[model samples]
Target: MIRINAIPLIASRTFLPRLPRTVRQYTSYNVAVAGLTESQEEFRNVVHDFAQKEIAPRAEEIDKTNHLPEDIFPKLGEMGLLGVTVPEKWGGLGLGYLEHTIAMEELSRASASIALSYGAHSNLMVNQLNRWGTDDQKSEYLPKLLSGEHIGSLAMSEPNAGSDVVSMRTKAELKGGKWILNGSKCWITNAPVSSTFLIYAKSDTSVAPSKGMTAFLVERGFKGFEVGEKLDKFGMRGSPTAELFFDNVEIPEENVLGQVGKGASVLMSGLDLERLVLSGGPLGIMQAALNLTLDYTHERKQFGKKIGTFQLIQGKLADVYTKLSASRSYVYAVARACDAGKVSRQDCAGAILYSSDRAVEVAMEAQQCLGGNGYINDYPAGRLLRDSRLYTVGAGTQEIRRMLIGRGFNELATAEDIRAYNDATINGGVRGLFYGIGLSLPTHYILNSRVTAYRNLPSPAKAFGFVMLIVPCMTITAEKSGEAFTRSQYEGVAKRELDKEAQIEHERWQSLSSVQKLGDWARRHKYGLVGASWVGSLGVAWALVNRNKHQTTSQKVVQARMWAQGLTVGLLMASALLTGFDSSKTEDPRTPHEDHTWRAILESDPHLNEEERKRLHEIKRAVVDRKEQLVKEASNSVSK
Candidate 1:
């Protein structure tokens, strides 16, 4: 049998060709297998073997008893799975997110409940501490937690705060150099078993909810700290979840995780990675379900033949396989992106959202393939189905995920529009500045006007003029409104011209390959382009100066116009150095029409009294009527 280190040697010539020579010397052929490098695949294999041999055997018992084995964490620690993403100096494996994801997937494949608890301990607690904890905090907490001598958990969700965590009621007040925490956290995973807890509370409620919060490291042994009864969960039964009570719990100032009043930043820093890692849980469940179904299908008989041979069973099997493959690919891809420090919030949410939904469907399909056996607890399919459902609700609900993804896309579009509008305003300001300068040169030097006359005006008049001139130049509203009005007056002519030009530009852009397009964009905006324009402008200016000495009156007038044109063009080119040009369409800044639906109105102002609601409805009706009347009047005018 080949050892783990020897994997690269066997396929060095064939599989290592695509990789860099340095990387190929160190990497393995598994890069081509499942997007894993040698080290990642090797780590995955080790975790998988340990999980299948140890945890898989106890999964059923853990589910039935609603308790994970006492020795489970220690075993995991021994395997270096607890700190898969932590540095080796902290008694961890010093691996990256992909390796951590693989470890989670393999453990979850054995027992999802155990995996849930593990994720809470390793990621929600340990990883967060590693990131935000002070050196002393890390030194104090990391060793025991990593060694499995103590469990860790993060407490953010309170009784009234889940998705809206900022609205949490837990409060912490500093009194005489000690923080007094008085509040409770509910639905906290591993709360019943954890030794160290990362707790967030409102440290200064006078400020905004998000800004006033603080995170503290609380020990289970702290005074007045209590863990309430373990929750009776329908799924993930073995994961010990409970409410935590803090009553006059005193914490030292050094115990503050990160800075006080910056808990939101600490909380947000880990959410994307948290979502990416926990996504592996659903993926593992899907794989487990598929595996159980495939085995049962091959062995179990129906209609005098193996059920796997039947077309319907084969179709179900194929669907499960396809979903598992797709979900795994997405999870792995996201994990790799996270490791590369290129995380996307929407993609992170999307990965969990898509995988969790697909996992539920796949789990149900797995049970369906088992026919009668699937519905019973003995088959493990029922448990898989139950476990799979939790993912949609946990780590923010699927509804929250969908909303986040939608908001992310909306923000992206809005940002692009804002960027384009800013670019247009800057370009317009540059043109105005150059034109003002060009006009000023002739007015100040040639006309010989007295500058002191304007300066002698009253201070108020000068201030008023400055405000009027600057406000219009600084704002985009006036410029965009003017452009819109001009287009409206010559609508047909402008539309035809714009459409023709747009079509030609679109065709030209589409004809270029992606690489060519990038290169073309680079060439257009390069410093060399600006330098060439400056050189040409200088050449024209020199020629105009030379010709002016020998020119007739009309020729001199033409030379002045040429100087103005050349100066304007040169300044425009120089402006390119200051800002990027965006050709993207800018959105109009008009307010959108109000929602007329009752649900919309209720959501917008949920606390509205009956009288207020009636008044709002009446106002809405009047607005709608006025809009319709305007439309009718416009139509009549057009007809006339």
Candidate 2:
């Protein structure tokens, strides 16, 4: 007997499609993108408070005066934010890339311009300098760059070299113990105010300036140095940018950054961070825009009704949510990869390339939602819109970033690479979790939060934080039961015969830590994530109508959808518990891998060639198998 009920799915259809757009988007990615670490979260709160109190309050005035954010950096220095990614021993926070990006998100909410100011120091110049600078140079410069006392800036683009570094004309020639530097760099951020600059200049006769480029630490008092005319822009006025003239300035012999010719690494890698940071800048802006638009639409009324009542406005809000949420997850994933150490240049380029393009789309949409108010200076969306244009321009243009990202993908992706890539994923899945979550505070907290959020979810719209909880719950229960039943269905002799081939020595058995098993199982059934969010949202809504009077009909509809979603999610969890190869025997509650019960067969295992390729096939098989079994089980359970 097949039991099919159209009633809940019907209600889901009504409610899930109508959720407040931004709310749904954010909820979808809470776990996928992850969030700030406990330490970083504290820093984020500190930054938020600081931004609100110091920067947000003064943003209007700063924009009006087109002033440089010279005053803000002192406090940022005092707070240890400017050097968050700089090594701690070197007079900086040493929090790393993810934390640094999180800080950017919070600070930029106050002022895109000010955020860029901090970015110019850490992302553009300081990090590169740390990687490429000489020992003497590091001891002398790192402390200052990390300190608020010495500002770091990059002088690479000239009037002619905006997106084309190969076209740079600035030249430096050997002159005994000094290198004679000539030509000028334009659009240099923190110019005039910045104390130190990573000045890139052509050093050889290689015809192509890019191949001959050399990076030098040109100090503020360098001879024959000047800040050119300060130019005004459409937005982000609080941070200043200008041209830097190098009129045959002399760099000391020891000032050679990285063996004179290795400047390409300095340029590409530093710019990768620049673009990544640039890509991340808009997360805050988009989030702020979402918050602002939500407040504005809900507060403002037309025809004696809130504008939020109209489907048109809801539609606009949904678009903003979708774009921002998608972009945020992608950025976080990429940023986390970089933070994990040695992110490929191609990966970094790909992420930022996608990020900036999305920023433009979302920011513009947010502006549209504000209507006439969005155009006026009184509202923030308009300013953010103009300010965000630099995201597409700075750190390299969107067009060029696309070219770089595309070229990278062209090289990395191929049919021959598929098996190797798959194996890597499998290996990374178990071990990556061990290392990434084992040491990472943010990743640990994020998963914990997702589980907590799932447990606390009472309605559809609010219950959307994590998708991992569901698939594993259902898949494990069904798979284990089926296998057990299949084993039971055979007669004693048949079952005994079957067990031999399928099973090996207990000592040979490899098991996943409960968390790893859950993650692996969940990854297999990832498609259920979209199903739960969309369908579950509707279930929660409808469940609300039948179950709770406090909620409006629409809200109730959403609750019903969520309730349905909760079932699927819970089932996946059960599935994981039942079918995992190794039973969890740990008593530690702090984290899943506490006693190291999880073991994966990677290079040592004969079953899998490569971790990535093995995991890909395993995941595909498990998930598809789970789905087919789930439908049958759901039918049987309902019929009974």
The number of clashing residue pairs in each candidate reads 0, 51
Q: Per-residue lDDT tens digits of candidate 1, residues 58-124?
A: 8888899989678988888888788888888878888888888888888898899999999999999
Cα distance off (Å), candidate 2, residue 388: 1.1
User: What TM-score would every model get versus the actual structure?
Assistant: 0.63, 0.61
Instruction: Provide the clash count, candidate 1.
Output: 0
TM-score of predicted structure 2: 0.61
TM-score leader:
1
Candidate 2 C-alpha lDDT tens digits along 512-554: 6666655555545555763665466555546455766554554
